[model samples]
Target: MRVLVVDDERGLTRALQRGLGAEGFAVDVVHDGDSALEAATSVDYDAIVLDIMLPRRNGYDVLAALRDREVWTPVLMLSAKDGEHDVADGLDLGADDYLTKPFSFVVLVARLRALVRRPTGARPAVLTAGDVTLDPSTREVTRAGSPVDLTARETSLLEYLMRHADRAVGKVELRDHVWDAPGEDLNVVEVYVGYLRRKLGRDAVVTVRGTGYRMGG
Candidate 1:
């Protein structure tokens, strides 16, 4: 999918370009807010990565302008500020998602992908993929309207995969987020995925040869 990455840090943007390109995204980058606003208004992008701090115009101003003009492309806001108000402000200004600085590349990708997978400018209460549906509020999972009882750990694993549906999430990413096991063996990831497959059907999760696994593939 086409993505616009807006940031003044050339080095970081370059790294993002290489990484996101490898993950199968067409990335176009702009350094300052004015350039970002120009490119975003001129191009039809699937998603956008907007940093809060920028030269000439700030991200909030650009975002407000986009929303005012009815540009509803999914936007993932970025900033060094981690305050709750800072995040709330971005969302209030029509940001689809937000990430603080020093964020995990994997999580950032997952967050952006989640926004892209959903309807533009909407976040559903229930996440669904084909016949499978998950309710984050109740920790409930159903396949074809039938409840699928799973352990707490299994549910956490399934939740992570479902949140990042249609993307091949790496083992390291899964382990760290789901299991909170930073140094654990990848074998654990394999075993839990196997559990999910047995309960959710073999086709529920697809195994990418060199990558880790993908749900809703």
Candidate 2:
């Protein structure tokens, strides 16, 4: 799954980007509320981790704007203030869940999983295509009920493909969603697709010549 993390704390955002990336999530991060709003609006994130105290706009205004625009992405509001009123205000403004600062990383991940699984038209805990099955929560992939070892990037790529099983996915889309860095070469997508094909069987992912790739032939 993909997540958008909005926080002014550079340390916190970097930590989350690393931790969540290691957990097999494609994470995009922005510091201020304006960037947060722009990113959230442009991308279809499975979940959002929003900080209340922001530079340009606060989390409340961000959440209200998203709701006003009819964006239903699940949001987990984070704040240093653990007061009941603060929590209630975030929820009232349409945040799906709330977490106070200085919280446990384990607890934060658990809360995120809970929010993602709440059936907001988000992808399921497990994704399947043909004989291959992938569980996002456990970061496990199985083919014909047998375990498949994959690098973190491979897991993210396969998940993206399986989620859009119906049509072809272009290299640009894959690069944008699966990769975090800017100025990455599009050839990386081809390289990883080759890796996946070798592991999952060549017939598993078919190249569409001029287009990109599809899950099955």
Candidate 3:
């Protein structure tokens, strides 16, 4: 999975990247809200680790913009402020979950895993397109009843494509939606698309020529 970590505290961001990477996530870290918003806007993240206090834009503003733009990627807010109102405000602004700072990394990991396992919050925990099935709750993928093994990036990409199934999602859209901004240059989109094709099979995603890519039978 790909995760974007936004925190003004450099140490915490680095620690998160290191720890989450060790846990098998492709992690990207950024320090301020401007870069944070840019990253969030431009890349695809399985989930975002955002802080309330930030430079240029507050986490609330960033969260609002994301929702306003219809970016539904789940967000896990991390902040020093643990006041009831602060948590409520984050939730109200469309954050999927919240965690106060000085937290246990174990809890953070658990929360992230939960988010991955249930991206849509639906009870059955299954998503499908054609013969493909993704069980977010189980981190499992099956196509025509056979298992498909995907690397973290491939899984994140496939999830994004499936979430927007049948729509011609442009490379720029995929880039901004799937990969965190700073860690990616323009070519990362093509690279990961190639990765997805290899792992999921050549015809799993279709190129729309001048448009973008679409997922569906």
Candidate 4:
């Protein structure tokens, strides 16, 4: 496996190169964030070992840029600052894993192996259907670049439909999953569907005659 090591510490970088090379990994080392970003975008490494402190730009900016450009290569962020907020910031920006300074080399190798073995197709937090977008984390929805306010039930219902976009979802199935209970009134599904259609537009949710509904304009 190939790995990109982005760190300014020459001794640490050299030691990692030797250790990781011995473990049958082809390692390329870069000393700064700009170089890291350039190398990451130019070549598709199996995984990246990125350090938080670097020249020109920091690791957060580098990882953000990579994700913004749709580069999904797994990243392992390294840092001397082990604060809770620091770790959260790195993860929130898309670093797959994090290691603080004074970490074990053995542990680092194991983490890298685990990261590379993980499935790379982690879904984006946001979901979109045509011009409609839903952020489950924020419980926010927007249609055609405009905010669309929705109640909790409507949000849950729309989220379900959007998740199963292009597929006709039955009312009973919707109730079973999105509603309070499977035994709850099925008419509520129809009511919410109507609410979604009226709020989002008539064509937002398509009724499939005998079947339930599909999301998309």
Task: Say which candidate scores most in lDDT.
Answer: 2
Give the true-structure RMSD of model 4: 16.8
Candidate with the greatest TM-score versus the true structure: 2
CA displacement after TM-score superposition, residue 181 of candidate 2 (Å) = 1.6
Reference-based TM-score of each model = 0.57, 0.89, 0.68, 0.56
Q: Once superposed on the true structure, which residue ranges of model 1 sit more than 4 Å away at CA?
A: 121-217
lDDT of 1 by residue, 1-217 (tens): 5679999999999999887766545578898989988988987676899999999999999999999999988999999999999999999999999999988998887786677667354557788888999875566899989999887668767877776786889988777655432477889889989998999899998898998888853
TM-score ranking from best candidate downward? 2, 3, 1, 4
Q: Rank the candidates by lDDT, best first.
A: 2, 4, 1, 3
- Work out how many backbone clashes candidate 1 has: 0
Candidate 3, residue 63: how far the Cα is off, in Å = 5.6
Summarize candidate 3's per-residue lDDT along 110-195 as a digit string, tens digits: 89878865668752457687888876545588888899987665666777778678588887767655554544675887788888
Q: Number of backbone collisions per candidate, in order?
A: 0, 0, 10, 0
Question: What does candidate 2's lDDT look like per residue over 76-122, in tens digits?
Answer: 99999999999999999999999998999988888886777664655
lDDT of each: 0.82, 0.88, 0.80, 0.84
Better of 1 and 2 by lDDT: 2
Candidate 1 global TM-score? 0.57
* Residue 12, model 3: Cα distance from true site in angstroms: 1.0
